[model samples]
Target: MDAPYGQLIEAEPGVARLLAPNPTPYTFTGTQVHLVGRDELAVIDPGPADAAHIDALVRAIGGRPVAAILVTHTHKDHSPGARPLSATTGAPVVGCAPLVIEGGTEAGFDHLYAPDRVLADGESVVVDSRTLTAVHTPGHTSNHLCFADEAAGILFSGDHVMGWSTSVVIPPDGDMGDYVRSLEKLRGRTQDRIYYPAHGEPVAEPQRLVRGMIGHRLQRERQILRRVEAGDRTVERIVAAAYPGLDPRLVPAAGASVLAHLLELAKRGLVSHADEQWSATA
Candidate 1:
């Protein structure tokens, strides 16, 4: 995905996006911080605390009054920049309530966010001419949200769904059960025509991708179940069986994802874990 960072890339009539310069293997060409309203601009996912990114956002607005600074969730890559941007523009940061998540060890999660106005599910806020509704879709994290612009038929599907790659569902903060339910919720909603995902290109057929994502997750679960039934119970072994020739750099994440699925399956009484080994329940 090409991110025209310094200038505003017009996505549609009222929507424009600024790319943050903090791209990574996970972030995928930096975070696509969006300017939602044409006149009374609403900044969404300020994208890290880098001065340059925030300055670029301010520049793109071109002295427009920022109605609100909205956040999709409190990940370091998503919410850390909101405070600095708000301080610069005097726009109150509003979105999901902060929920502390235990990141275990490597690649920690952010819990230092507090929104000025907490938005509940089905809550709508009119900024400029657009009505952005909050969709409480928790999966990637306990407080993950996807904002839906009904009039434009575009949904800002945070990290919950992406066009570039499947979202990584790690345990502790991430839940497979909630992820599946959230995908179902999006599939049922007809208001969204395109998904402007945080880290990738716009998803034109969101429902089709949602179905495929659901199937992919379930199939992975089945593979884990099969591995467990075949006497491979630990996360590492399951990851090895499910994702052969996996990149060494991604092993930790793969293990976390398998653990999340195992935990979910265990919660549903479909599997059991004891003495560090898992088994399919009869």
Candidate 2:
């Protein structure tokens, strides 16, 4: 599965991956577009709207008729190539419901995804032999979805849950409460043993990783509470206190995460948030 455009990981039956050539600080090893099926295929998350990557994707399909275009979310590195690829392969674009920004969206979110068929949670689509059941795990964004292969017990966990870095909780487009709750949602489902993430390598212990993610969020909440109680009012100060030695590049993301936690805490009556600041509910 050697690809000249991007690297290819060893895939199992009915699945192959083509990493997009758009590697950056955000996208660890470039965005991975998964090709699922035997002869005919379903291409998922066709990376950035780059011609080379699209050509690579079409080439990888190797004359196989593409039946479906599945996208997990609408990040710039994830779904921008859907339309062009659709034109090339004539496969209908289908994945998570279109972008619905709640509070606000970050700089890099792809808002142009037009799905031919809107999919909901538990809605399943069969492309060749693979039947991917959409699992609405909205946290990274309002419409993030994770597709599951129920029979094989494998999950295509998008940026909602990744193996490389903890998914950034960018509010108000991203919600910590929803993110934490989604982590809890996956924690109980012990059926999925492996997860194929969009950016990094595949994870074998999805349950353990998900459980750890849940615990990490809760622990982060506690740390944020402690920081707020210790007289850190602003999100920046709280983030500094909560993440003492965080990488400078990730400080902004950490601040957003802390803000999301504070907002969620305010909603739960555990903290008071007002005027661009947060405080302990004394």
Candidate 3:
């Protein structure tokens, strides 16, 4: 049966998983997480504020004590339900601070999160017999976090990593440099064999997936540079040329990705910008 968000694909025993009903240009899929253990189970990324979805999650957990509600970031589709769920279950909400972009408002973050527990990089939350370690992998959003479960050997990688699509790097909320670094950090980790991303199925070979993501970004950057060499100076023009066949609806997102790449390229001195136009510098 198909849910409103996307098809549900169960991964790893003891974990109740469901996809949200709403899929959009922005949210490829919605993920509901339920972690069951002895003392008190927890839910991560409880999905949107939909009552039915939240109800489905509550039903799935079946009166099991909800230990905590964890959020990866403050994106609307991801964190808006934390307050209601916390109130319903009396579970403490936990997450990093909402990402604040310089000279810009907190676009989609939830100021209402008011996490009872705030996670730090490398911090771990012990539930029953499992340990969920928080890895601050900022890139998709500055406050993003990935939870590594030592016992399950899995990583609940919010938007930091995905099985089907590349994560968007929209600045000033996103940074390509930080994204690449976060990918590299994941590559260096030794424990995780499977990645339960915020969207799509569980990734069995995370190292391979990480390498592919890094390579794809690099390739896209090269294409953008080539576009610059061919006289497409503005981000809009470059994105049009490089992503010629992308859905029109996705062009705006593509522009954001191009902007992120351009920003990173500028930092490396490979490209320079003047008058809002990018040019190859080397």
Clashing pairs in 3: 4-21, 5-20, 5-21, 5-22
Candidate that would win on lDDT: 1
What are the per-model numbers of colliding residue pairs?
A: 0, 0, 4
Consecutive 10-residue window with the lowest summed lDDT within model 2 = 1-10
Query: Which candidate order results from sorting by lDDT in descending order?
Result: 1, 2, 3
N/CA/C clash count, model 1: 0
The TM-score, computed over Cα atoms with residue i paired to residue i, of candidate 2 is: 0.95
Report lDDT per candidate: 0.87, 0.84, 0.81
Candidate 2 residues 1-282, lDDT tens each?
222455454478887888888766567768878888887888888889998888878778878899999999888999889999999889999988878665765567787788999899999899887789999998888889999998888888889887688998888778898998888888887899788889787889988888888888899999888888888989988877778898898888888888888889899888997787778996
RMSD of each: 1.7, 2.0, 2.1
TM-score of each: 0.95, 0.95, 0.93
Score candidate 1 by TM-score against the native.
Answer: 0.95
Off by over 4 Å in 3: 1-10, 36-39
Model 3 scores a TM of 0.93
